[model samples]
Target: MTEILLPSDPEVRDRCARSMASKAFLTVWEGAVRSGKTVWALCAFALYATRSPDGDFLLSARTTATAETNCITGDYGLLSLFPGAEYRTVGNVRMVRFRTRQGEKRIHVVGASDIRSYMVIRGATFGGWLADEVNMHDRRFVSEALNRTAMSHDRRHMWTLNPDDPGHWIYSEYIDRYEAMDAGERAELGGFAHFWFRPSDNPAMTPAMLASLSRQYPEGTPFHTRYVLGMRCVAEGRVYPFFGPSCVAEPPEGVRAEFASIDFGSVHPTAMGWYGRSPDGAWWKVAEWGPTAEESARMTVADYMDVFERETERLGGIRRDRLTIDYGGGGEALVREAERRRWYPVNPDKSVLDGIQATAMVLSSGALRVSPSCRRTIDELSSYHWREGRGETVPDKVRDDFADETRYAVSTFIEPRIRRRRRWSRT
Candidate 1:
């Protein structure tokens, strides 16, 4: 026997209760991490299914794997979160077949990464729809998914996504544009509603944990702006909003380890960042050199190396082999130069999203900090943001040399160490 244990968070409860009682065609939950919105979504999905047992619902995510991980199978999985819930997948199809008060229910699972994925729902009709990471889906898929819904009055939708650049369609198309229109406009565009949340909304999160999480992202950083305060205030495209005053502390007195990260930018402005790791596992930006555009246009590998070595010495000395340079095609020359001089080649993790995500994760934990002197790094991170129109959000290539170098260094050096400690803690 399972029980539906909704969070006491009023916003979550009110939003979910609204979905259950209201006839609005769409209900969206947008907010910060651990806010219990997802739990609300699961409840709404189940309640909707029960009301129309003969109805078939459609559920999706960026991918089927993610759908399961985020909902059905993850630690806080929805399947087990509700009591007396039993489901069976329908054959080889992407659906979870179950029985509820209405009689028979089927919740179809699909991935909406591309337009082609829409074929999964082609010609079929849905009683309800639930989409996770809706922002990641192609517009065509989303449109098609909506079209596949059954015409019954019970048909409804629930969507969730983290905050992205304001330019994101989630804001322009859904939040303000599509919903909240006048009766005539909403009647023409379709009915919809939304709710907002933050980590503080989850009472299960202890005060100490919240403080630790708060420390990870100093105020004014994008992570803090979105995840902590739950405001859509971060500038549309800036990537590392976590590099401002709160994140910049005076150079710490005890730096347990030292290393350097280099992004070779001849003409584009090469960046070298000296980082120190303390016993507390925080990574600090101790020193950096991000030359002016004009200077980088002609600065040679040797010129940058001279500055790099001096910065290393000033930061209490890092082993020469630990000096890492980017090996991505654009930085090959620098990598070659470093190898020639016995320096380490920091193989750039080509997955731009992964590196950015890693950087954000570190910042959210307050483990990534910067020195006041590393103005270049701070400036770059402050402005680095996702570029729109690519069908995907990637950090704009411009004004990101130091940002890239810093992310590569942290993902390469700090994340691995953090993971090891986490693994050890379980034992």
Candidate 2:
């Protein structure tokens, strides 16, 4: 007979229970929406709380409402999985506490509206920490909440989150680095161990739920691909999936563009791409000139200045307010020197993903056109490949020089309002 009781799957429960007991620094459960990530998270911590002594467990979510709705407390009927537990509610504090016979475990369902709430975890030791929907949590939680556990021994931090694309902060910090490690990255032990599963991995899922999901979301849809299969498939990040060499743009004659972006490489060729906005609100990549044989022969700053002066004259006397440079080591000084020669020096706001997204939106919308003079930029954009596996692929360190330059190029000259934020603060 099928097990009709709540938390009926022993394998799922046992796997979660064992991971919590192992006290690994990071235990991630990447699963589909209905694959029982929440159930496994609670069962694991509750089971550990029952087995261990003098340790606390925290159940944190993006908000208190989600915490209550997701059944982190006994009121959600999920606590029925642990029949031997008693729940006490303190209405004044809006908190719920659970106790098992082996040892008492307190579950704090804290809301994260701001960074201040996370400060409470400082110097607080926990036997188990359950961060639900961790991807959706603010970026501040990592430095505040997780870092505070550095001094604790035998403590496990468990993450239960539905998979998001590469743009998310947690995916970049944890999952990205974990994948970058080589076979021998960890000595005497092994590489960081991670596990991913879907609702299909669990036999407990009902046929009705599967059919309902299929009917509600079509194949290839984000919801279906993300929530139903729990696969980390991000189609948006793969811009220009089928682009080829035919669409490369050529430089135009009678150039009136007054702005350019400079990527100064002292040893490498100092590179720059010139641009101008058309009447229809499209950006035209008019010219791209990097270190020629003559400019690359020397590493002196005067050599860079000479090349800059030539480009400035070639572009019909560049406006001193329109030049942008990468905020690299010693780049500010180069910009200052260029400014001394009456060329503008500018620096883009540092937002990698958002800036990339803005440039992509323009490119896909046909609002960005590349001139034939910018041949290397076009070639690099074409060859920029998405990293294999999942989440944000480490920008290829080798073949990504031109791609990186193009990203910086668009970030500097693309005057998109959404990408630019006006900062104002009250005194």
Candidate 3:
């Protein structure tokens, strides 16, 4: 590791000034992975930390170790960037105390992870705040940090993170303010300005880094969009970050059992998917069929059942015990129909967020594969998202039945133990 020299790039220099001078309560740096965002963010915080600083300041991340490793300990670390700073530990917490021409300054290191995360820094009134990988933090903790920072006359914040889903709160809460400010509709900076960084912006990044990224994420993947182009796009926010051609394959011959997953919708398409699980604990979507919203309106319950039976038989032999259908939407008719066929009513793990995470876990590990013949399922997997204020992982309510059914399959089979985990796995 080498000392980080602040960039002399004119655009970077200009943006740094704009960010520091802005009146916004929060300034955000978002872009490609391994962009110089962390260094840029530290620069902004350093300025706030020492320039006539008042009250305590905060430097936080998703965890305390990350904040220390990323900013405080490395060669270009915060202590190195500002050599005169004094470091000490108070009780369980670590702090950096420094001097400004106007006064003394302190930056307390904290970690923000969940709803109760604000407790770590609850009593401190910070003049400034900075958090790395801000997207991984709970929104409540972020809000609390901002609220606490109001104590300072020179209130500033530097929140940094890799580009994430378009629906992510950072875009709505911080990035959007920059947009409104740019459009000349706002008189003030609104305590929000965002600087985007691409990997190429960092002089240290070599051609080898680009090649490794291409090999890991490839073009046309969500990872490429967020990490390579550094664009905050719709695809970046997908629930399944790794569903694509690479995961499409024929069902393996080691198939132990076959099951059908279905989502019922009278106004929406009723999606039925066949999945084959390998004895080694892998799964593949062997086939999928669903009716369009228009066709569903004309079809009677009996007609729908007939279609389901025919599709089931077409995919070979799927036993009644192996069929699962979502209990939401217009599922009553489907449930009744399934009962007539002597099949069990499918009641899956109803926690929508857990289900989405479970699906992502499977897809990311390459444990779940989709057959090319299951085109609709493949398309839905690529597009399902977490939108509407971060809690809900919903689709646009159209062309999503297959995705919903897959969620059932995922919640039921992929992480049948989600009840124990209770939240998305950070690992």
Q: Indicate the worst ten consecutive residues by lDDT in candidate 1.
A: 81-90
TM-score leader: 1
* Model 2: lDDT to the true structure: 0.60
Candidates 1 and 2 compared: the better one by TM-score is 1
How do the candidates rank by lDDT, highest first?
A: 3, 1, 2
Error of 1 at 350 (Å): 5.9
| Poorly placed runs, candidate 3 (over 4 Å) | 1-3, 6-13, 16-24, 84-88, 99-103, 181-191, 235-427
Candidate 3 Cα RMSD after full superposition onto the native fold (Å):
9.6
- Decoy 1 TM-score against native: 0.68
lDDT of 2 at 190: 27
CA lDDT scores, all candidates in order: 0.72, 0.60, 0.73
User: Residue 226 CA error for candidate 1 (Å)?
Assistant: 2.2
Using Cα atoms with residue i matched to residue i, what is each candidate's TM-score against the true structure? Answer: 0.68, 0.49, 0.56
At residue 148, what lDDT does model 1 achieve?
82
Q: For model 3, how does the per-residue alpha-carbon lDDT over 285-402 read when each residue is reduced to its tens digit?
A: 8888877667877887778778877877766777787777777777887788879878775676656645665666567657788888888888887876645454322545556778
Which whole-number lDDT from 0 to 100 does residue 96 have in model 2? 44
lDDT for 406 (candidate 3): 87
